[model samples]
Target chain A: MHTDLVAALDIGGTKIAGALVDGHGRILLRAQRATPAQEDGDTVMRAVEDVLGELTVSPLWSGARAVGIGSAGPVDASAGTVSPVNVPGWRGYPLVEGVRRATGGLPVELIGDGVAITAAEHWQGAARGHDNALCMVVSTGVGGGLVLNGQLHPGPTGNAGHIGHISVDLDGDACPCGSRGCVERIASGPNIARRALDAGWRPGPDGDTTAAAVGEAARAGDPVAVASFERAAQALAAGIAATATLVEIDIAVIGGGVAKAGEVLFAPLRRALADYATLSFVQRLTVAPALMGTDAGLVGAAAAALTRRNSATAAGV
Target chain B: MHTDLVAALDIGGTKIAGALVDGHGRILLRAQRATPAQEDGDTVMRAVEDVLGELTVSPLWSGARAVGIGSAGPVDASAGTVSPVNVPGWRGYPLVEGVRRATGGLPVELIGDGVAITAAEHWQGAARGHDNALCMVVSTGVGGGLVLNGQLHPGPTGNAGHIGHISVDLDGDACPCGSRGCVERIASGPNIARRALDAGWRPGPDGDTTAAAVGEAARAGDPVAVASFERAAQALAAGIAATATLVEIDIAVIGGGVAKAGEVLFAPLRRALADYATLSFVQRLTVAPALMGTDAGLVGAAAAALTRRNSATAAGV
Candidate 1:
């Protein structure tokens, strides 16, 4: 009557989250700690351990078979290390080894956060029934992952489907990542707000000048605000179309802060997609909002662990 | 000992070529016929049958175990049909069925010509040791194929790596493929010549106005010619970078006429790649000229047939 479970962790600059997830992806226990991102490597490790410490104490811990970590990248899944840009202290940090030790040498799997989200969507969200798909997050930065031939394709470095940084405009403005006119440069939340501000769209009485505010203004019929969102949509469409052309995906699932703007983003995005996704095979590609919400990373990490265990068992390894 | 061989057919607008290939990839025998491209579908198919008939009459015919067809696309490997743009008479033609019948009901496998070339590259050419790669042909048109996880990824319809039609410059000139600023629209051999001519670079007195002549002019220090090649390289860089970013390829193997321009095309391609492929995982991507010669399609088709037969045997199907 006992059910198998996996321990899952979602590590990002802002926080470290841990959960005990069952076979059906139900979270049985949860714990979290704010990331000491600005501190030294050891301090950040302490935060991750604190989150794991709480999970280990639960009576349900003994049922867990493995641990999965979905961390902000570039993570070296091959080398079991991470060097997140925002968390300078964690450069080349031995995250997998650290987590493995804390959990009594349980097997560990690590992937980029974007890939983890894609796994979650492919498992039980907008991309559930699709065999080939691209799932994306359009928050402060645009990050993404691919599901190819019905399996999550976390490339050798665990960073396939990093769509945000792909150049859509070869001669456009320079991005912080040392590229020009990347999708993230034009479609990320910050970029949307910045473009609107640069085009003379001012904040309201509350003085909030976020991308969300720009979305609101566009919904209220502000031409400059509308123009900024339209531009972001164009970049996203170009990137998405390029992905489909390369890998033959049938659907693109989008999430994160910018995607929450709903029709304000989706309408322009769909229209622009028609212009770029003109190939017969890609002409039928559909874009949909992601359904997993905030728990996607944790759930996806759990999915990765479960799938790995199943595959190994099936192979009699 | 009787060695098992595979019959491979490379069907194009101008020719229908057949080969009997050994396990070691050597072409043991060959046959070819001029394609009746402008004739009715039945007539074009008759040319293909004639090439196969010659192969069948060979004393070594009894050694052939399977057949593979690499034809101009878009081909539906699943539906066993083909609709190549250049062969207007073959729209939705039952190509696989016809070949199957022609070869005495031998098991047949079909793939697009681009995918076939990629199979050759992965099996024995420039892409040979790389696990994930993109192989492209930049001739009168741009076409390509992908190898992911060390296997040829001929997507559902056998056209996963059709990179030519993906828009790189969203606002640039329209392409015949219904997309704007496709890699082919700017980087194909004909486009390279057209761009150079439009920029006021005239051909030599020999009146040979091909992209090769333009390459010679650029090597001789014609600024306009160099600029046109540079522009083509820029667009190619964008498309190649996009492929690597989306799929995490470590190498891109380029073939065909434009790739033959040597450093005049490569110098700019490598430099422009630096501008677009800025991500840590993709920054190390290497560009190499394809090593496979004109027989790539036939050799690749043979490779596909051999691989398919091996896979089927291993599965005990």
Candidate 2:
């Protein structure tokens, strides 16, 4: 039996994951290696190469048509390079060329991790069937991607939907991104927990200062914790609303660690969304929890691969 | 010599302007009528019909193949209707259908005025060669449209790129649209004037308290006036930067009344843009004054018509 497949790679600060994905998005085979992110650029490339090596040795690898890599951004898809902040060694790294060589010259498609997740969500998760959507990951830092006019909008650099860096508070705190009051600065897990701590909310006897602890405190009716989460929700709502206004997306699917706050985050988010997304066209904008889970990055990379393959076929490549 | 042409309509609160535009975007003929904006829906429709009537009576009318309308938004291209805030008489008006019937069954394409301006700018103005751009009209009210992947992105309802309503100051003043700290709420012409006046910058002997007056004062080194324009520039910069961040546009073309403030607006805008567009990809974003002028709406409408006609022809419709 012959089956077409794509080699997918999800490269982040913590790990390098690769998979052979079938057309229906099923993972036929997988390999992973812990990323030596703090090491030199060659060390990181070695980790990615190891993952590809494992996939290449598989018998199913013969069915793979192309390679797709969804790596932590900011990635330059136009230049086939990446300079992820967390992976300091990979600045302006020629990742696509490296991956192409490792994969024996197969065609490659590269997108930011946020865009990849959006591709996965749009293809098989919360944003399925919706022609226009904004998919976001609100964890350590808020990141996002847009699905405009029913196609993934990875812009020229494959970093189009980097919503976290967009300023929601022009006169507020200065962000590490050099912008003022960016969404991630206000809504990320660390920011939420920090805001809670700064506002006098003490964590439980477990002394856990993570956003998860803050979320538990919020659920328990701690005023400061609740306020911090609400503030994060407000910022998130503002960013989401701004996105909908700019591009006419109808849904925003949020995932990552902070979204784990559940109703404590969602309730205020919806309320703030009402106030911000007040335009008739955007008033109906809805937010949903992301459904692709941990495998989203690999699945999304595969989705990008399939999309590129299909487009190439359509172009008679 | 016979040539294929399209009829274009630019509908607004004060006037209904119509033109017979050729494939090359030249206005071969034009007609206009004052809008009976305060009248009933039928009356406003009659005004639009009158403008169309003049164009229909023209000897060159036979060459017209379709009608393109760029109307004050929010227009619903998907529903073929409009509900512009200024034209209160026309709420959910069947504008596309009305134009289709008035033009004797010519196919009609409806788009928001901002989108129309964007088309004009992309086709023959400042954003001509840019593949991804945001064209803004910062006047009595701020409005905008987008060009993504070298095509107009009108979204489903013809109201994408409505940047005026997106909040940059989330906890700031409430906008009439029910959003807080919207770019328009702070950066529109009236807002600029109001901010200047509020800061105690009195008008000259002419007592003209317009944004233009503020611009003159700003140019004359009035600190309050300069501060006001700078503030507006800050908000506009934030919105523009946010747009670029979300969509990866390389340029922002600003047009309309406030833009006439010239360097008073542009100088500070460029400075503020640098502060907000901090990301590597977005760092190169450039802001330019729109070049299409007052005829931008009509020309843009024609551009949309031509684009739609070409697509339809390609699709063999």
Candidate 3:
């Protein structure tokens, strides 16, 4: 049985991204649709169908044999349902069944969006051929995936590497995930801006309030912006240290928008990690940007489909 | 090619423990000796040799084939040397060589004491057959080891699961490792007592206090003791929650005499873990007691030696 083309979709609270990727780990065609913010499960399902329709009819996916979906938090892969916290009306929705129906039963698979990114990066991105790697998306929010022993750890419900909530400080800011001082609450884009704003640091007479602006200001030597970035970097470094200390990772490939702050963030991160001197095993941590960019989600989603590409060809479902 | 008898030595800050362990994970003979606090390198080596001499001549080590040494921090396994912080006289000491000469050149292996304990638990104790586990000794200090994908994770120097130094609270106590708010300084045996003493609770009429006596008081309904255990539990829960969220550990087997507090500690731990409701991945955290007790170090040392046993046989070195 030959399998080449596969449909991939990345589901988030803000947007839903879809693509047609072939066996070569290349996205042949792509499309995006805004998440129907307050829409019910059926409405989101329709969005998925519309996106897939754009791909299946395109020349790229005309020969595609299977589909894969990567979604936000707390996915039950075995049951093919998702209970994403950010997206309303998405409690225990049968996500795989919806995609299967959209593709006319072309064998769809589901995985946590973070897990998908990890698998994609492991298979084709910077961390390829490395058995133990931590894939993190430091974007609008932090998300992660674990590749240990050359296989992905999906945990009890495919939520193994939700490292955004890993505590950097117990007395830290309260995270949306009902925890305090999670890395997300301190380092995510919005959090960076929030911290700077809370610190009463204004970039100029006119405030362009946001993490992107904070990054720009920090680059331009805005004290508050710089401090916020340092704080986030320190927290990120601590978490990275703990991760390295525990997992003994060879390299930490950091993706996501906030990473764009670049050296302003990495310098402090390196310093804080150095302060974790007592741990000798993982002190030799190598930090790098993820090779894959915006399309990591789509690529990761596609990798998940390809892993089961054979099943799509076998039962001819 | 048969392997059975081996000498196991545990080097701690206050004392040095040695034992003769058989193939069945049983200690055939054992002894504990005081560590020479102000001794030089040669002096400590002589002390180690004296202990080895007793083990080899005993009934247990009459047929011993090798030696396993589990020592305090900062070890270079490849170089067969140790830089123990507790044994200041032994900086860059050739521990493997010392034990070899003492045992008359029988094969010798050395590992981080924490790693040895972790391996011991996995091989014959609480973490049996479980490929993923973390064993923590929450005594006067907290130290740990990770077993992921069925292999012990000893960071570059075999000190991987050093959770004691992992920062939990930014405002928490300053750890001896130079980190601020480490779990060790917040929840460890002595920390529990110290925090309680500061809270105006006399552990006893005379303050020759220890974590064990505190546990006894709590068991006997001393409110101060109960509160101290709760604080420690809360801190541990936060730390454990962060770890569970990051690594997706299947079980956390806590050892050390401090864990004898039992429900006094675990109850608050479960409550604090529930506060992380935003994180769906770590909800099913299970806290269990360590099974090997004080023998953990000896058994772990033995298991660590056995890992080298196969390699030694294969290399014919």
Residues B261-298 of candidate 2: C-alpha lDDT, one tens digit per residue? 89999999999999999999999899999999788999
True contacts kept of 1: 0.68
DockQ score for candidate 3? 0.42
Q: Pick by lDDT: which candidate is best?
A: 2
What is the per-residue lDDT of model 1 for residues B85-185, given as tens digits with 9 covering 90 to 100?
A: 88999988999999989999989989889999999999999999999999999999999999999899988778789989888787889999877888999
Best by DockQ: 2
For model 1, residues A197-267, the per-residue Cα lDDT tens digits are 99999999999999999999999999999999999999999999999988889999999999999999999
lDDT of 2 by residue, A54-97 (tens): 99999898999999899999999999999999999999999999
Q: What is the lDDT of residue A250 in candidate 2?
A: 92
**What is the per-residue lDDT of model 3 for residues A186-241, given as tens digits with 9 covering 90 to 100?**
88988899889989877566668878789888889888899999888877877776
Window of ten residues with lowest summed lDDT in model 3 chain A: A276-285
**Which residues of candidate 1, in runs, are more than 4 Å off?**
A1-3, B1-3
What are the candidates' individual DockQ scores? 0.77, 0.93, 0.42
